[model samples]
Target chain A: MRYLLIYDITHDGTRSKVADVCLDYGLNRIQYSAFLGELSPAHQRELLLKVHQRLGKHGANIQLFPLDEKAWVGRKSIEREERQNNE
Target chain B: MRYLLIYDITHDGTRSKVADVCLDYGLNRIQYSAFLGELSPAHQRELLLKVHQRLGKHGANIQLFPLDEKAWVGRKSIEREERQNNE
Candidate 1:
């Protein structure tokens, strides 16, 4: 299965740690605060737990969404390669 | 079908306008720069065009993803309700 994880963390430290956790789970950072990649159902649940633990008592918002192939393949994006920080 | 629209626009004006467009299209602002809601495939295409027009070569990154019922229903979220702005 595939998952799309997006987050908004006010604390810089917490945000960085969260991003690291996502990478450890093999998720790619698709946007400044968004990650997308493949994961087994079990891994997905485990990842959420880890994220929840890190987000403890922090000001943040995170959402993890499961995306099937049909939905993933149908995604549309517009980006500017020249932008230094696309975020 | 359900769509997840997320973007990173540096230009405050452009970002604000884009948010307005999403609201006009009957989308809910799920996060600071992310919107989600139901829309027909045709409407999805049109929405993208409108967002593109608003970008107007600005340094922005936008992605629109189609998510079916299973995926949408499987979404997991963790938020701090007290946060002034859950961006």
Candidate 2:
């Protein structure tokens, strides 16, 4: 499954630190502030725990949305259209 | 690319009504309240416009996230894990 992790850092310094931690954990930064990654439920749980441990109370607000294949295709089509428009 | 549209209705009736319009617009309901759909930029724009026009001031809050193929694959992997665990 694919997961979109959208998070807003509380401060600029925190964003950089969070990004570093995410990179270390095998997650890729998709947008400026969002992450795109693949992980099993167990891995997801581990990832969240790591996030909390590393950032502690200073961690940013986060929302994770899990997508199935069909939804993924639909989102991809929209992205293609957006890219085409931008080009 | 994949897109996830997450929305929260103001009331129960609004939820049912929004679901109906989403069904009419070639979108499938993924969660009880969320929609999964493939749409081009033009279509996305049109969809939003229609949603606004139909629901007017009563429309629910909506957020759309566009994803790339890689992200979609990742998300799908997570969903598979979740489903497997459920089964």
Candidate 3:
């Protein structure tokens, strides 16, 4: 299952730690605070638990969103051309 | 159906125009390059065409991903605490 992970943490130390954890799980960084990857339900739960441990009592919030195959087709992205159009 | 829109454009003018179009469709900005909202299939297709029109021959890419109800509940987010934790 494809998943989107978005997070907001108070501590810089913990925030980067979360990023590393997500990368360790093979999730791609879509944005500074967002990541995307394919993981099993069990894997997803495991990552959540690990993130929770890092969060500790800092009161940070982290969210995981599942994106099914149908949703995958619905994704859109735009890449700009290298050359500029004067017109 | 919930949808996520992600885009990259060469021109600032076209980029902001796209953002306005997304807002007109009632989508929320989840990030600088991403927007989220619920749209019907027809509406989804309609928005796609409008976005395409805006692109013209500039070679910008825009993608729309459909997110179902099952996927919505799978969303996760974190909010930081207001107070400092000395401990």
Candidate whose TM-score is highest: 1
User: What's the residue-level lDDT of A40 in candidate 2?
Assistant: 77
| Candidate 1 C-alpha lDDT tens digits along A1-87 | 889999888888889999999999999998888999999988988898998888766778899999988888899998974334454
Model 3, residue B12: what's the lDDT?
A: 84
- A best-first ranking of the candidates according to their lDDT comes to 1, 3, 2
Report interface Cα RMSD per prediction: 2.7, 11.7, 4.2
TM-scores for the candidates: 0.89, 0.47, 0.69
Docking class of 2: incorrect
lDDT of each: 0.87, 0.59, 0.76
| Higher-lDDT candidate of 1 and 3 | 1
Model 3 C-alpha lDDT per residue in residues B1-87, reported as the tens digit of each score: 778776667578888888888988889987666688988878877787778777666656566667788888777665556445674
Model 3 iRMSD vs. native: 4.2
Q: Lowest summed lDDT over 10 consecutive residues: which window, candidate 2 chain B? A: B76-85
Instruction: Give stretches of model 1 more than 4 Å off.
Output: A82-87, B82-87
Off by over 4 Å in 2: A76-87, B1-43, B47-87
Best by lDDT, which number?
Answer: 1
**Candidate 2, A37: how far from true, in Å?**
1.7
